[model samples]
Target: MLFLTRDLFSKKLTILFLIILGTYGCKTKTSSEQTAEQAPALVKSPEFNADSAYQFVQKQVDFGPRVPNTAPHKACGNYLVSTLKKYGFSVVEQTFKDTTFDGTIINGRNIIGSFNTANAKRILLTSHWDSRPFSDQDSLVKNKPVMGANDGASGVGILLEIARVLSLQATKPDIGVDIIFFDVEDWGATEQDTSMLHSGFCLGSQYWAANKHIPNYTAYFGVLLDMVGAKGATFLKEGYSMQMAEDVVREVWTTASRIGYNNYFIDERGGSITDDHVPVNTVAHIPMIDIIHTKNSVVRTFFDQWHTADDTMEHIDPKTLKAVGQTLVQVLYQESANLAL
Candidate 1:
């Protein structure tokens, strides 16, 4: 009877050990599974359609040089307003007149659009729409107006496509977004013409900065796109942008690098430009940066076709457009992930 009791005790002890072991194994497996479930998923930005952007540019170029106060300019302005509305944005047409460098009064319109109206934290994007009146830099055809396919229309086209993608997204970004197509930016006085009023450039932005679409409007940051569609374009950081909004510029350049666009967005300092972002930064008090394609050195010639009649569709590369557009989309959408819940 003593021997039988010993065997029974041994069986009981073995069963208890097995139960404890099973419980521990199950707990370890559960802990690993829980950890995986808690891991954060990577954020995904919407795809930017380079073809659509290219087509939008073509449409604007088809309207001829959009010089302010001309028939083509008026028609293009109307189209921009309509397109923004169609993309589910609250469009605002800011109309104002400003004197050009040559002392000519020109009618200008700034087309502004907004997305995610409920969100108070906003980001501003901008580009010029009006073409230069004369291709003064062109050795041949100095009397003709600039086509502005890359200088003006390219930025607008990319923004329009971005707006379209935003509208079609399944999940809207948590931050408010605004796009402004500022006119009269290219009407600045030439360097040689010292007698002309140099401040006459970027008139549309100057007007909007003083009289914003919303009273006392503000954005967390603003990005200005200029000369972004040139073939083999290299977008070095502008000097003013780096000085005023270094963090923003770093964020953009890093994002571009992350997305295999390090070639287009070089990690170098570029010459400061008096683009529309200048008024937005100084007058509106927003930290604005210009993502412009400028020469590496102080020469800052901008591009081969800059201010020339050769600034046409032939100079635009779909790859260049995609690089800028994709990087922009990634930055904007990733910003959503950074917002407070």
Candidate 2:
């Protein structure tokens, strides 16, 4: 939902600025040093149930597009809160009113579920829940609201499956885990709309970053998922994630590669996205990285069904979900074991 606007001259200037910053700020450690510090330790992660994840995605889409001010949106929110409560996590719902770019007042809710609540060391996982209001990118159905099976429900579904696994495990991690479902993230102005407002998207994340549920809250790191369930989705090292949390990004990409998912998790830089992670990194000072799908084509920068009514359950692939979910579980389990030592 992040948009960057610039003229041709300004685009060149921005590129120059990035090159200068990269030259001055970016540094790399030798492979030997990295290998010595981060030994090849095999950690067993929890079983990732792709079927469960797929069902979760379908459930949300069945409720129709979860656009703000709609009955479906309210129902899905309630369902998420109730489901998390059933999973034995301490749930907190942050509700607030936000004004969109075109001066539309809408209700937004950020649902957070905390595991091992007493532990101070923590990691935050998040995804947006609200579907895009307008399918402006669609050539034929430009006025329709997108179903957002991949955009909205896919990430949340993965997190929900993670929660289910964490709930059943006997030995919990020492560090707390927060699964956050942000709302009203896709209610921004369309590309055709000429309103030069940057703050339209990611409303719920901005609110949570400013008014954290826990006072003076901080986490060791955070990971965000977006458009992750598409078929043959490649998660390149997103530019914004590299800029914000290079260490975390490296850890995730390396873990994926070691776990035989290098084809999906490529070790190359993608475009700089302005997703929910941006607000968390900038305002809350949390080193957060986004695992999002990116394409190298002019047809659609995202997936084929992106922002289209055609984005349905058929596009949801269990293999992609398993790749992301299993990699994350491995990371968390390894981190927990290190903390125990």
Candidate 3:
């Protein structure tokens, strides 16, 4: 009877141990699930369609050189406005006038489009739409206008593609997006011209900075794209961008590195350029960065075909466009994820 009692006690102890172990395992699983639920999931953005972006670029080129005060320029501006409206954005055509370095009165139109207008948290994307009035950098066609396939149209094409993709989504980003196509960006004075006004370049940006489309309009940050579709392009960290918005530059560059575009976005420092971001940063009080392709070896700190008649589809690479556009989309979605957190 004593031996039977001993065996019975041992069995009871074994049963208790098994039950405790099972309860512990269940608690651990529940804890893990709770932790996962607390963490925000990665938001996946839409795939950037390089082919569509390329087609957009081609459409602008088909309008011929978009020099200010020209027929092609006006027609292209109208198309841009209509396209933004078609993509479900509230469009604003900010019309203004500015005098060029040569004292020529030019009609400038800063096309602004807004997505998710009610959201106070906003991101701004910008590009110059006007082509250079003359190909001063081309030895063969110094007097002819630049086609601006890469410099002017590439950035617009990418942004337009982004707009289209966002419009198709049932649930949009957590933040608002604003696209501004600045006019009269390439009508500055030539390098050899001595009668240059200090405010000769970036006239459209300057005007918009002073008189914004919306009163007291502000964004978390702004990014300006220039010459981003060149083949074998290398985008060094620009100087003015680093000085004005180092955190944004670091985040953007880190994003590029995280997504296999580090080859295009180099880690080196580039010279400061007097681009549209300057006025946006200083006058408008918005921290803006320039994602411009710069090479010290090239004249005017730009690509080989900059401000030249050769600035055409021949030099614009679809791979380069994909790299930039994909990186931007990833950044936007990632930002949305952060907002969720």
Candidate 4:
């Protein structure tokens, strides 16, 4: 995913999304129409373990930064595949090569694990697992690797914990759930605005969306998680998601509120973040929303320790993980129950 301060014009998209959504008033959605992605969900939601999620985050951090082509990256990727398979998921490793913004031909992998694959009603959950090679945001050692405790690992951790929880359940859900860990998402050149070239960042998502694991693949909707494991992380409804999947955004935010996570899932509008979800919605034509954190205060222009060396596990908060994890489980369980009905 690309990162920039509003001041960086030459290298940023200059997302004036506030002007697009913050100042504007939204029309009320009809209560009669149930959200297609959520109508089938059950009232009883699944449990999400914050301790397990935190351990998953720590496990990834123990491997050091998962920079592509490195030993840690390869080992971590293999670990993810093996772990998902252990959880009884049908795992597929989609590998591809792409040229980065700095003209480096890099290998990328999109690891997809499918549950209840035959179910027609499916929900896609995704997070980029690769850490940035250079923490350009760091004042010192700007070229060193980023820890990515929240930026990459946190989202994946929540999903992995979700997978673990599903596997342990006595009964499986009627609806399908697919979790994808995308690579090469944080390797874009900070000095270049590669968005103009249509190949800025998120190479794995760009590849998977165009050439999906399954031919003619489609999900009811997708939710991409990023920077979801920090203290006081606020998830504003992102602009691009509203444009592509307004119903999905509403469904997720409403579910969060219903489940007592209203504090984390704020109703305010967030900037148009260009993340993995963009490719899923655009290239694959799947309505997807990004549950990502943007600058929620004047003190910090980004999430806690974003793209910096400080994005370590110490800054991670279990409560934040619980909020995101529990909310997602609620949505899925609701879907599962609704489908059975």
Candidate 5:
């Protein structure tokens, strides 16, 4: 997740009356009538295993800091590819050399796994796999590498658990699902570095958005998970998500609310962030929304441990992972049923 250094400033709220209208614009049918017409067989989403997700997070952290140009990074990349293949997914790795903010070029890889590859309707779920290079936000050790347990590994861990369930299913969903682990997303310069480089952060996403793995890949929508494992983490509607993909945001948030995760998925608007979803929305033209933790009451940006060395396994909460993972499974299962017709 990107940090917002400036003070909290509000932008003019874009009235999303159209979305509200469309959402409520059912053909003038009464509530009971609509319920009768729409209520049908509901697919039960499989339970998401929090223990397995936590183990995945721990496995990544055990690799030490997954910073680029490091042995841990390379090993973790290989492990991720092999793990997805073992889960019965069709895996593809996109490797490239990315130039960082400090003029250092490092090898990066974007690992993708597809389920039900023959389906035309698709949903893209993504998270960054690389840990930050420096603990710039740490008060005591400001220059050390971070473990990125919550920031990077947590999201991928949840997705990996989802992949495991998808692999074991007897009847696969009709819609295709792609899980993308983007690299070089955490190599951005510190806030102290005042360089004018706009695309320094999220290098892997920028590359993948421009040169997609498939020739002309597209999805119905995309959901990006970031900083999701912290305890008491609240996910507000990010500004960029509200601007770019309001419908997707509503769908995910509404699902979260329905699943009793309303406390974690708040309804307030949050500051605009420059994370991996930016390139996917702008370059790829895929409506993508970021479900990220925000520090609203006290700190105005991300969680307190963000960018800090303390962002380790101790900061990750299994409850939070289960909440997010369960909600995502529900969303996918419901979307699959809708797309089947």
Candidate 6:
């Protein structure tokens, strides 16, 4: 995803006004801080297993960079499909063809996994799975592909672990959960090219938002994860998210703070990003927020190794995964129990 600069923001397509809904209401409660007022029938959400999530990240890295149309990409896609199936999710592989900024026709697949499909109220979780074909940001290997351990695999790993845990749980979430892995997201023009900035990026999400796998699919709200497994990560409230779904962002960040993850989920506003969530919000009309690592550093808005060959397993931290994964689980379970917004 590209950071939204002043120029880009000015040139951005107008986002449709989102009709926000209020449905959940609950005071924050941690494992050790449950009061009588908050203790009544609230279900304690399961602890996220960081180690398992790390292994899932490692497994994807072992397949090398998952650049779309490559052998490794195909193999990894199959593995993801099988893993979701093993977790008992109703899977949908929506395939499409699109031309890249360089005029290369790429075969893309947006993978969807649905849990508790019978329920009308659903929550959406998503992340891009395909790695960039070229490391344009890396001066050393500009032509090489990025490993994307934290950028691509980390979010998917967390969602995979969530699926595994939900499958084993006797009491399922009252609301349905839909996990989507968007492909061909990073096959876009370099940062220097301002003209192709927004139009070239997020191809997969644009397709999925326009042509959903299920007819007339909708979610209560959605969360998109990116660059979530680095050590000492900080997730600022994204600009578009604040504009489209401020209440959902408040709920998620507030939940993170209650669960001792305040250090990661910062309370500052971040620059608007042209990511998968944008299309989901604008085209599909589903309010979705991006939980991505951003910083006020001089070097970069994202992680140190973003879009570089150094984005490997060495940079991934299990603690960060646990923070994000556990917070998501808590939010899901809280919604499942019919808590008021």
lDDT of each: 0.89, 0.89, 0.89, 0.88, 0.89, 0.90
**Each candidate: how many clashes?**
0, 0, 0, 4, 0, 6
Tens-digit per-residue lDDT, 1-341, candidate 2: 95556687799888999998788656756774675467658667779899999999999999999998899999999999988888898999999998887788898989999999989889999999999988877889987989999998999999999999999998776678999999988887675344543447889999999999999999999999999999999998999899989999998888888888989999889888878999999999999999999966676678888888888889999999999998998888878877778
Off by over 4 Å in 6: 1-42, 192-194, 197-199, 339-341
Best prediction by lDDT: 6
User: TM-score of each candidate?
Assistant: 0.86, 0.88, 0.86, 0.86, 0.87, 0.87
Between candidates 1 and 6, the one scoring higher on lDDT is 6
Q: How does residue 339 of candidate 6 score in lDDT?
A: 42
| Tens digits of per-residue lDDT for model 4, 115-201 | 988888999999999999988888888988998999999999999999999999887677899999999999886865856444477
Q: Per-residue lDDT for 1-341 in model 3, tens only?
A: 34558889999999999999999987676643664465455467888999999998999999999999999999999999999999999999999988898889999999999999999989999999999999988889899999999989999998999899899988788999999999999898787454553448889999999999999999989989998898998898899999999978876787787778999988789998889999999999999999999976654678889888899998989999899998888888888778767
Q: Indicate which candidate wins on TM-score.
A: 2
Cα-based RMSD of candidate 6: 13.6
lDDT string, candidate 1, 1-341, tens digits: 34558889999999999999999987676643564455334368999999999999999999999999999999999999999999999998999988887888988999999998889999999999999999889889887999999999999999999999999998988899999999999888766455643356889998999999999899989999998999989999999999899989988887787678999999889787778888788899999999998876555468899999999999999899999999999888878787754
TM-score of candidate 6 to 2 decimals: 0.87
**Which ranges of candidate 3 are over 4 A from the true structure?**
1-42, 192-199, 298-300
lDDT measured at residue 263 in model 2 versus the true structure, 0 to 100: 90
lDDT (10s digit) by residue, model 6, range 149-264: 99899999999999999998887778899999999989888854677646698999999999999999999999999999999999999999999999899888878887789999
Q: How many pairs of residues in model 2 come into backbone collision?
A: 0
Local error of candidate 2 at residue 140 (angstroms): 1.1
